[model samples]
Target: MRAAIPARIKLEITLSYLATGSSYRTLQRLFRVSRPAISKFVPEICDAIYETVKEYIKTYLMKPYSRVSLTKEQKVFNYRLYRARRIVENAFGILASRFRIFEKPMACLPETVDKIIKACCALHNWMRITSSNNYTPSGSLNEEDIDSGHIRQGSWRDEINKTLPSIGTVGSNHSSNLAREKKDRICRYFNGEGAVPWQE
Candidate 1:
């Protein structure tokens, strides 16, 4: 029954919920759906979205041609795309427990489903923007990971040498720089100086 929902919406909601840590019951309440239906819709949506876009995100992996062509101007876009996926992937645990939006089997006009999904996604993105400031590392490993080691940025040498790499892709090296820059920017923007190595 719940299987009738389109896969795109399911994926968007899954990723958004994961990013925001909102729950099925809460989602049910917000969307007016039953918890059972919420449960039914989430995973299938996630799978559908992954199946749809998995190939488009090859730059996030170690694939060779995925990284070589990126110029500095496009660095930030690639960084955000790569990091968004990483964050979404990492946030799965948070999504499963924190967010399960099954809000009372939402009664929506068929035309407005897109609006709901976009609204949710926008809200999720805003939360992510704010999350870094309020976010606390839950584990010692995460704490250590912050200072693991600097990845010296110069070439696609390591990326290419990896079992599979993103060497030839556009903005690959630039994306690396963007990551470092994002770390610094986030830390500085949030006044997390000294606490985050990126700030120093």
Candidate 2:
């Protein structure tokens, strides 16, 4: 008699296969499931996940886009929102790179394809949150990187120090000239003096 595969094992295998964009045949070999079964369940589970998260997507992303002529506060809000949305783009890139399966066209039906994509994103988020703290890049920064970091930090400090007005001469002409000079110095530094040579 054949033993039944556990539900947890099935879920994990389906998710791993979808998340990595591995072929159903590939999943069959790894999980010892029939290719048909793997193909059917991956989409089913994906649909379930998509259903669960659909509300969140509509609430957060269905709003109107911001125009460039907005007020300062609105502009800041839009800028921050744009930056935050970049995390989603980065997540997709990371998933595609890490899972070679996603690098190719997924051969499943369109509905199945959509479900599989959603499921993989969910699995990716879960894995990222649960991963250990020791997952930094493989090696320490090289000398050039270290030097570049120091140079940027030093330039920032110098610019800030030069721009700040002296405490004793709040309204004097000398202080105003000093402040203007400080601003000019900072502008020059950023424009060329403090910039990395390769940045051009």
Candidate 3:
């Protein structure tokens, strides 16, 4: 058997692949490492990160309740959940823009792709927390003042289409129905026992 590659080299290769979406052969040429070694360590490191943070993932990704079971107040709470989805999408957009690898098609197995994404997300959150001063979104407002009573507009498409869609939460599949149901339940919980005094 060949000698083992060092952990530092493995880390650099894995991160470079995730940041650039470079093919294994390309990475092999660039890093002077074998394609097999690159493939092996990248997924291994990603899986380790995922396993380490699985609990946090579960906590943040709780399922939503269905809409059919929602009360009027519960429905309003559910609407807030829908609004929160924009935050997730905005985070994704920021991640993709920062790490161009996500912008390109990932030419790997689905499981491997998931691991890479999870690793990147974990790293991104860690970086944001540990080094908040170093990173700023390009052409956006100063990151420092974002949370300082500044109203940020999520989109500018209202001028293009003032009318809202006619449909009202019609799902095309059982999974969608289940997700809606979960949201409604969460909403009910929030508006009732889960609510805080400060919430309007």
Best by lDDT: 3
Model 3, 151-176: lDDT tens digits are 45433222122332344566753465
What order do candidates take by lDDT, descending? Answer: 3, 2, 1
User: Which lDDT tens digits does candidate 1 get at residues 76-122?
Assistant: 44444464455553443232223333222334444434444443444
TM-score of model 3 vs. true structure: 0.67
Q: Of models 1 and 3, which has the larger lDDT? A: 3
* Cα lDDT of model 2 by residue, 1-200, tens digit: 97866768777876677546677777888878998877767777677766755443422331112355764434444444454465554455555544445656778898877777666666555555555132112221111244444311211122122322334735542434554455445445544555544334
Query: Model 1: residues >4 Å from true position, as ranges?
Result: 1-12, 56-200
| Candidate scoring better on TM-score of 2 and 3 | 3
Please give the ranking of all candidate structures by TM-score, highest first, separated by commas: 3, 2, 1
Superposed Cα deviation of residue 187, candidate 2 (Å): 29
All candidates: CA RMSD (Å): 14.5, 18.1, 6.9
TM-score of 1: 0.29
Each model's lDDT comes to 0.44, 0.54, 0.66
Give TM-scores for every candidate, taking all chains together and pairing residue i with residue i.
Answer: 0.29, 0.49, 0.67
